[model samples]
Target: MKKTILLTLLVVSSFQNINSQEKREKDLLTSRKWYIKYMKFGENKREISDKTKNENWMLFNQNGKAEITTQGIKSIEDWNFGKKHEIINISEDGKFTEYKIEKLNESELVISRKYLNKTTTLGLKK
Candidate 1:
């Protein structure tokens, strides 16, 4: 009986830890505006035109709304994290796209998605 109770307690603790980790990651992602620094398409890497790195940006909200601004135009979209928190889903109108998280932290984010036969990666910084 003691072993069973211990095992139950361990499982619950692990679940709570995982839940808190996911919440923390989500908060980090939604806390600030991320500016585009560069983009990589397969073997080629291209830097953003403006040295200031503020020409293009993306803002994620906790309410599942996102704003993407490029060349001074902003578009509203819906966003959600995948089940495992490894992917981000963005949808506009009826079309949707999945971005796989390559790296994420307090100040930097890197995400990649497939484009045709090549993989496109976007590097962003707060």
Candidate 2:
């Protein structure tokens, strides 16, 4: 009986840890501003220069909304993550865009978007 209790406690603790980690990721993403740092368009990969680094940013909110600043212009829109947290959908000006999340962490996010026959990779940093 003691062994069974110990095993159950271990399993419960493991699940709690996983839940906490997922919550942490979501919290981090919504609390900070993310800037575009790199992008790959077609076969060309380019790094953002200091001169243009402040041109684009994304601010996600816990209320299922996001504000995007591009070229000093701001737009508010609705955004959501997939149930598995591997996809991001953004709707703006009646246009919906979906991006596959490649990586996400405290300071960086990478996403891949496909439109038409082109696939573009975007790297963002906080």
Candidate 3:
């Protein structure tokens, strides 16, 4: 009986720890300002443009809407928040793109698209 009680307690504690960790990660992701740093694709690329580093913001509205914007490009994104918050899709002007975001660390996010065949790593701004 004592052993069973101890096991149950251990399991509960483990679940609580996991829940806390997941919550922390979600908060960090939601609070961060993400930016882009573009780079050339080929090996013999001459110079990386200084203009590549552009400031971008991801704003999450109260109604579960997300907007990502840079200088000239603006996209409206959809998100769902439950145990985990996920980016579902983005529509820029009239074109639609599907994207997924994953937390690489507390300060970094990895965003990927299948049709675009691209993945971008964004760093959190202090």
lDDT, candidate 2, equals 0.84
Q: Give the TM-score of candidate 1.
A: 0.90
lDDT of each: 0.90, 0.84, 0.54
The TM-scores of all predictions, comma-separated, are 0.90, 0.77, 0.54
Which regions of candidate 3 are displaced past 4 Å? Answer: 39-55, 60-63, 81-103, 113-126
For lDDT, the strongest prediction is: 1
lDDT of 1 by residue, 9-124 (tens): 99999999989988988999999999998999999998887665565999999999999987677899999888877889888675779999999999999999999999999999
If the candidates were sorted by their lDDT against the true structure, best first, what order would they fall in? 1, 2, 3
Q: Which ten residues in a row have the lowest lDDT in candidate 1?
A: 46-55
lDDT of 2 by residue, 1-112 (tens): 9999999999999989877866776797797889988889878898886577678888989998898887779889998876666778889687768889898988899988
Q: Report the C-alpha lDDT of model 3 over 3-119, residue by residue, as the tens digit.
A: 999999999999998778756655665665555433222322233233543435565554546767665476777654443344435555555555466444555665554433444
Best prediction by TM-score: 1
Judging by TM-score, tell me the better candidate of 2 and 3: 2
